[model samples]
Target: MFELKIERVIDAPVAIVWQAWTLHYAEWFVPRPWTLEVIENDLRTGGRSALMMRGPDGEENSSEGVYLEVVPQQRIVSTDALKAGWVPAEPFLVRIDEFAEHAGQTRYTARARHWSAEARDQHAAMGFEPGWNAATDQLEEVVARLKRG
Candidate 1:
């Protein structure tokens, strides 16, 4: 198994960051030319979280997972290894998102735990870093706009 972590200090409060991440996720989950269609987002433990990401070429990738833990404004742990009702699914990745308050800013961390080195490498080769960075940038923009309102 392999793990990858990314962190960024968002210039916003933890609440704003959390709200952007949870409530407005679809708005910034993907970079330009790509779009995320949220099929379901329950935001509770054992609830389902599913989405279909459409690429620029119109290719669609679907992901279905169950929330393992949800701590409002603090953390969220989910895995595609299991579906709703804790039913076993093909193992892929476990994602953990954590938020912390640091000097009035939001310290955001995204961790991806893969089922194998090959899976991790595949994700990395797919431009995970750049893709995620761009998504975070978009998230920051969304949060900033929402904060202004």
Candidate 2:
């Protein structure tokens, strides 16, 4: 398979969740102790999205991509296969995030589609599920705070 997926029922409205994803992205993109720095967050089709994850020990991972599609609070599709202006990029994976209203809560799904099964396996070995799960939990917390005020 070429896709890795994570789904959760977050305890917040879809609007709040969408706000967290778009406005307060760095606040919850990664688990605590591993902070994220959003270099750029153009939430539009063909716009650039760049972020840096800073580890406690000064390690950093930076990812740059272009949004392939953006549908407000409904769905987002981005890929590192091309940067801003559709420049050729060293491909990694295409990420798709979907959010839906479910009984006043948010039904969220994150999908990472790799170019090859080997790439998918490498991502799995790199702690995709647990890391993404922690990020989802963090997203829920961020949305909860947004819901408060």
Candidate 3:
């Protein structure tokens, strides 16, 4: 197994960052030319977090995951290895997001643990870093706007 971690110190409060992530997720989950549609986002353990990303070319990629843990404004752990109710599925990756207040800003960390090195390599090749980084930038922009208003 391999893991990929990305961190950013966003210029916003932890509360704002958390709200943008948990509530306004669809707004920034995907980059431009790709739109996100949330099917379900129940923020609790064993709840479903399903969504589809529609590309400009009309291609769609859907992902379904179960929330393993949710700590308000602090951390969230989820995985595609299981759906709601702990049902086993084809394992893909475990995603962990952590938020912390740092000098009036939010320190965000996103970690993806793949099932194998091959999977990790594939994700990297698929532009995981750039995609996630752009998504994070979008998240920060949204949060900044929300904070201003």
TM-score of each: 0.97, 0.96, 0.97
Error of 3 at 31 (Å): 1.4
Residue 45's C-alpha lDDT in candidate 2? Answer: 97
Question: What is the model-wide C-alpha lDDT for candidate 1?
Answer: 0.92
Best by TM-score: 3
Cα lDDT for residue 140, model 2?
82
Give the C-alpha miss distance for residue 89 in model 3, angstroms. 1.2
Cα lDDT over the full model 2: 0.92
* Residue-level lDDT tens digits of model 1 in 97-142: 9999999999999888998899999989988899888998999998
lDDT of 3 by residue, 1-149 (tens): 59988999999899999989988899998998799999999999889988899999999999998999999999999998988778888988999999999999999999999988999999999999999999999999899988998
Report the Cα lDDT for residue 148, model 1. 100
Model 2 spans > 4 angstroms off? none
Q: In model 1, which range of ten residues has the least summed lDDT?
A: 1-10
- Candidate 2, residues 1-149: lDDT per residue as tens digits? 59999998888888889999888888788887899998898989999999899999999999999999999999999999999998989999999999999999999999999999999999999999999999988888888888889
lDDT (C-alpha) at residue 141 in model 2: 81
